[model samples]
Target: MKAQFPIFDICKLSRCEQEDIFISRLAPFLDKHQNLLLSHKHTFYHIVLFTEGAGSHDIDFQRFLVRPYQIYFMGPGQVHSWSFEGKVDGYVVNFSTQFFQSLLLKADYLDQFPFFNGNVAEAVIDLSTNLHPLILDLFEKLVHESETVQHLRQDMVRVLLVQLFIQMDRLSFERPVHQATAYNYTLLRNYQKLVEKNYTSLKLPREYAELLFITPGHLNALCHEVLGQSAGEVIRDRIMLEAKRLLTNLSLTISEVAYQLNFADNSYFTKFFKKHTGLTPEKFRDGLFNQLSQDALSLQ
Candidate 1:
């Protein structure tokens, strides 16, 4: 049978009882939440403002230490979990992609923020204490607007979210030194978007380079300079991530997983998976289930 992961959609979770936006205090939210505090993906976006709490959060397999005056931004499709000691006091705001896209118009409008960048490996933003009031004020406004139907409440919420996004972008972690040039940055972002869209069918570095109107060598250099990974590695990583996702669904046979991922054959897919992840497909899937079981046992 297919192993299923919980996908929390804001609209569904809200049950139309509220708007597409949902806000709650972090401590109580965590008290009622179990699945998402562990590894899970959301169908909508999450902006967490950690006014008080200290621990770690894992996003897409990368773990980040959490601190007060810190905020975390997670986009749709990212897998994440959090573990913190002691009381966690803060706010969590979840809004649907539809909620923002209806206002922004651009399909990839969210991509403009550095933390939301597809190529970015981390998204934690630490701000100075002085900025906490301003940040918290915006969050409070979002919560207030979500509760009552006021004139232009939707507009006010959108305005606050945009302001929060802009402020958070300013506080985002700095890009690598090599990403300074606007041209290189733009090219890199374009490549990332292309990879997300076409990683399954367009597997080769040259294919992406052709789409970007650049030589394979230039693309490779840009990838290495800005992301510290070769163009091929980035492509492989995306494929591997998808492979893992599929493997979690026990309903799919190994061969089926390979076929779904566009591999020519099962054996070749196993080789590719092992090369990048140091585990055969079967072992990888078994290991993941075993680890999940252990986590459940420990919690009990």
Candidate 2:
């Protein structure tokens, strides 16, 4: 199959870019997108729910046929492409990373949400039947910003985002942790944010600890207490995930990918990758390619 055409971040639209979000119904453009199957890299954050149509998304190698009210997480740096038949309709809520960063200051508990891992996770309850109206209303408010009265625009947006996060929190599998942390909890949370934002760059624990205004030891202790993993371990997982993403999606050679990942040399990157994957880079790629070919042959 041909790789899909490139996808753009909707927030980059002229008007929407200023507001940090873009929302639109899908049916109108579904005809253009369905056959073309335009897919490529994206860096913005979003949560797309199919409110009115039955369609599908090609996420990595997983093809999820999106039914009505199905919600899929659109994380930063993940590659996603779409397709549908006539009148394919849904709502796309595009938001900036800043929006989520600030929201996490409050609903950080979503860190345990499992569906964010490039999988089509179903919500336990079909909240979209009720929640869709709220999102539509919020989108209307966002659409007609001129109507936002003096001193009320930011206030309205803050409330709207909070509501959205609340809905997401309800869907998370982790039983809610209502005990709002005291002053010290901020350290781990901030450290987590740092890891998320700069994991590709910061290889050492001290780098993150210094940024969070804490010692390496304290950072390690906090993560171990709450997550059963040290700060370094968390950083490694994020880096390794990015590495795997490139390996699976891009056509770059191992040495080229290693340089892009900031390894001092190919050998070091190979060792690091093998440590986690239990196979050399060449063997790993061959294994996945073989699996894909076998699946294709089986389908035939």
Q: Which residue ranges in model 2 land beyond 4 Å of their true spot?
A: 1-7, 11-21, 27-29, 35-39, 52-76, 81-89, 95-185, 213-217, 248-251, 282-300
The digit string of per-residue lDDT tens for model 2 on 39-91 reads 45566666665666655676653567767766666666665556564455665
Number of the top lDDT candidate? 1
For model 2 the local lDDT of residue 199 reads 76
Least lDDT summed over 10 consecutive residues: which range in candidate 2? 116-125
Compose the digit string of candidate 1's lDDT tens values, residues 2-63. 23555678766556765577888778778777656656778778889888878788777678
The best candidate in terms of TM-score? 1
Cα displacement (Å) at residue 225, model 2: 4.1
C-alpha positional error of residue 278 in candidate 2 after TM-score superposition, expressed in Å: 4.1
